[model samples]
Target: MQNTIFITGASTGLGKAAAKLFQSKGWQVIATMRNPEKENELNKLENVVVLPLDVSDSVQIDQIVKNVTNKYSVDVVLNNAGYGLIGALEALTDEQISRQLQTNLMGVIRISKAFTPHFREKRKGLFLNITSTFGLIGFPTCSVYSATKFAVDGFSESLASELAQFGIEVKVIAPGGMQTDFAVRSMEVGSHEAYEKLTAEVSKGYSPEKLANYTKVEDVAKIVYEAATDNKKQLRYVAGSDAIALYDERLKLGAEAQVANIKSMFTF
Candidate 1:
């Protein structure tokens, strides 16, 4: 029998890539996006079902999970729906803050909660959460975004212990910058004149040379597949060379020294 994976934010980028990869691997893919009508490719693939989901909406989340679980035995759930909220915190609006928190943090929590009963009853399942390198190490412009990812990281870590008794595995996929439209389409920048120098210094880190080394969406998707099927007790899979290097540096330097190291990169 073939297994099924339910993915959120599957219309584009890493989510879309993962859906395709899993489908190619002979697994059924339930690809959920905010607008399934706008999706053109995944809908046409065999063993792939495009469903509508706005992870921020609790009602939609519960209903969709119920409908999918009833019809298909979902073996994995991928929480890949989130966007970046960059720039100065002071420049960010209350609406932006709320949206980031709702979609990035709460969305993951709610989705995990919705599927907990099913996984618990079946006594086996996997949850692959798409966090970020920012989730592991703090950055200048990613305060809010980092907070959300960090919370998810911690949440997954704690939840893993509790769910292990039921054979439910919670894993976090933390990737660095990827060659995606994330910067162009999936990010919201809050600009404020007072913080121009800080944001500018931060912007310099995204040099062309650095971006050229960013990992491909498909590559990260492969890592997701590995984490899903590796059947190891590993709780975190850091994808992308940049992500691995940075995280390794953090681990080697220790927290305070790592913060100072990152701080030394920018002068504002």
Candidate 2:
């Protein structure tokens, strides 16, 4: 039987690419998005089921899980539905923080919780989360976004250890600066003059326009496929050559040293 996989945020970007790749590789894909009606591209794909799933909505998540369980035995669940909120910690509003957590951190928790029983019952499955390099390293104007990814990184690592006994594998794909609509849709800027200088520096340094020049969306999709299918799975797989280099550098220099380096770059 072909392995069954469910991917969130399948409407576009890495999720969309993964859906196509997995389908071509003969996996049954439950490609989920916020609006299924609008997902014409996914709907047209063979072996792919376009389902409505807004991760923040508990009722919808529960329904999707039950529906998938009834129709197919899901072998893997990819939690990729999330956005980034760029702003200074002090400048960000309570609501903004809540929204970021709800989608990025809490959404992963909710979806994982809903799928746990099924994976436990079957005693075989994979849970892959799409995290970022920011999870391992922090930067300015992305404190809130980094927090969400860091939470995912910690959660997946700990969950992997706990789930190992059950024959279920958990993995995190940490990509750096992929070319996607994520930057345009997920990025936000704070509106405070007090931190305008710092924000401007951040804008110049971490500009999506610049980062897109290096990372491709397909690169992330390929890594996602490897994580999903590899029998000897690692806890974390860093996507992109640039990301791997950065990860190596971060390891060489301890956390304190890395922080100092970043501070010097930003003239902080």
Give the top-scoring candidate (TM-score): 1
Score each candidate by Cα lDDT.
Answer: 0.94, 0.88
Candidate 2 per-residue lDDT, tens place, 55-131, comes to 99999899989989988999999999998788778888999899889999999989998998899999989999999
Clashing pairs in 2: none
List TM-score per model, in order. 0.98, 0.96
State in Å the error of residue 206, model 1.
4.1
Off by over 4 Å in 2: 205-209
Candidate that would win on lDDT: 1
Clashes of 1: 0
What C-alpha lDDT, on a 0 to 100 scale, does residue 7 get in candidate 1? Answer: 98
